[model samples]
Target: MQIFGITSQELFGQLLLGLINGSFYAVLSLGLAVIFGLLNIINFSHGALYMLGAFLALLGLNHLGMNYWVALLVAPAVVGVLGVLVERLMLRHLYKLDHLYGLLLTFGLALVAEGSMRYFFGISGETYPVPEALQGGADLGFMFMPLYRGWVVVASLTVCFGTWYLIERTPLGATLRAATERPQLVQALGINVPVLVTATYAVGVALAGFAGVLAAPVVQVNPLMGSNLIIVVFAVVVIGGMGSILGSIVTGIALGIVEGLTKVIYPEASGVVIFVIMIVVLLVRPAGLFGKQA
Candidate 1:
């Protein structure tokens, strides 16, 4: 019944939870990787955008009477549009400037977004109810799994890989890659690199938004939600090697499982486990597991 000082049930449950956490980690880091690869900007506002996505879903549910399913689609679209605007109005100008400028500007925007939300919402979390359709759990041999959480894992994996395939296997993705590698050549070939840049940013933020919506039912929707998770995601991005789509996905899930195991074995270390792994990765391979050294 017990495995390594913990029950099988407990282990399975924690592992399931870890997978769910990893789902979010993978999506968020994937977005970060994508944006960094193309735009060469570290998007500090990504967390804010994620927070906004959750709030947008909440708004849709509370004000517009939209269901969770609808919010899943609508929330990302709204936030994606916001991302495009941010790129056009703010980020685009900073592209030619130092990377530090992008970081600072986005960080400032994050502060403003969080501050505004706190002013209105008072930093209290708003609950988004799990949809009626997904309000149950499945009884596995070892443990019971929440339907929504299981859905999160499946949905996250599907989206993560689908994005990977699109970017890695398709012509659009090929064009996007070419644009980043050789913008002048892409432009000469009449690919409209600027438009592609904007669209890539939009897609990246949309991924963040999608993750947020998936998370809202599982966690309280709050201004600080994105802030809390972004750090871990960044670590995942670093450990997996930034801009490596598959690397991000695999590392995120693996770290999540490791975090879960730590919680079971040593609860106190759970909080810092991912960062600890990150430090170790930094020391061992400065370029990360899948990263190439410049």
Candidate 2:
């Protein structure tokens, strides 16, 4: 039972791996989409914030005696609060400036965050043990599946769609959209537009934190973790279309699978496949797959 000169088990296994990777992609890109869509910030610091979340989880477990479940909640909340401070103190002042200014600021912030973490923790990675309940694997006929990997996919999808629903279907979402488009008009209606903006940024960064926590057990928790993945995430966001929530989610997952398949078919091409797709998409649809043409 082989297809494309590979055994069924091998193919299925790679697919599963791809799906797990896709899960991370979806969550990270969702955060990027949220920030760019709502606040128009490039958020180059997103990867750093993600690394912060993982470190918070690690530190909380080591110093505060917190568990994975607790860290899942607490890490994101702490990061979200930090995000609020960043927004109120820094990002708010740049709202009227060129997008490049915001990008540069966040990029510098990312470098600072990474540098501080590296200085304190060193570049070596640390392992985070999987939670007790999810520490095993299940036999899935074709392959053995790790419970944690399955959880990552399920959890990522839930968060991604839940976010989409929140921002697309609810009255709150409508208000948010209105505020972004016409802050003065929404303010006339007694909405605290600035607060909303700040909160939105917090939520965006919090999503990144949440993703980091989820990824901690699966990958080596290191200071350089975020920097390594952020470029790919940005590629996902662009391929999905800048500021398109659903686009980011779908494109991230799809590209992950594509990358995985490429690994099986041509190992050398796997790393650059997403970039190639991005190039093709850009040439064809400058607005992205889901973006509206301006």
Candidate 3:
């Protein structure tokens, strides 16, 4: 059957691909939202950290004979620890300075991280093999769905909603939110706000790291991997609202589907469609679709 001059298969295929891409966007943007909402810092190094996570997985697999499952857990933990160090040794010092300072520092850090990886690994990309269990596809009547892609969507959604619930539903989340709005009050209440801030940053970047591992098999594991997607991910966060968890999740998936459909309808316009939507959203709702008015 044909609809709008496109075969049903082609349409569904693009939708599936878009959903896979959207999964990554949702996870990455959720991390960005968490950091910005809590730390009030623009972590330009997020992409670099994501790259590092994939690299760690690659290294672990090659050097230590680790499997995909091991790397899935280890890579994120390692990156989260590194995040803790960065938060304590560097980011904390600049908390009182302008937000621009944090941005510049992180941007520089991203460059250094990417450059170092490029130096060691070279610009050419490497591929991480899919886990044996997820190597096949399933016939879903409308389309053949790759098991790994389905897993990506499921995993990303779980993490996104889990994080959202943690922040928006739980007492710990309540404290975290309270700390952002009234750090002094939260601190006076006997909470170690600095430690909490550091932990929050670690968790945020760890999400990036987790996404990296998920993506290692889907895309080339190159130093520039994170750099390539960071801008779009940032756009996702902005459109979702700067610090709105639900906003990020919804916008990421919606834009991903929009981009996918555009590729089918007009290949040339697909690349710019999200940015165009972003511009329109900015003009209509300067705070973003879900962002609060300042």
> Judged by TM-score, which candidate is best?
2
lDDT score for residue 45 of model 3: 93
lDDT of 3 by residue, 243-274 (tens): 88899999999999999999888889988898
If both were scored by lDDT, which would come out higher, candidate 1 or candidate 2?
A: 2
lDDT of 2 by residue, 1-294 (tens): 997799988998888888888989999999999999999999999999999999999999999899999999999999999999999999999999999989999999999999999999999999988999998999989888999999999999999999999999999999998999899999999999998998889999999999999999999999999999999999999999999999999998998899889888998999999999999999999888988888
Full-model lDDT for every candidate: 0.91, 0.94, 0.93
**Per-residue error (Å), model 1, residue 141:** 1.8
Worst ten in a row by lDDT for model 3: 1-10
lDDT of 3: 0.93
TM-score of each: 0.98, 0.99, 0.98
Clashes within 3 Å, all models in order: 0, 0, 0
- TM-score ranking of the models: 2, 3, 1
Give each prediction's root-mean-square deviation over alpha carbons: 0.9, 0.7, 0.8
**By lDDT, is 1 or 3 better?**
3
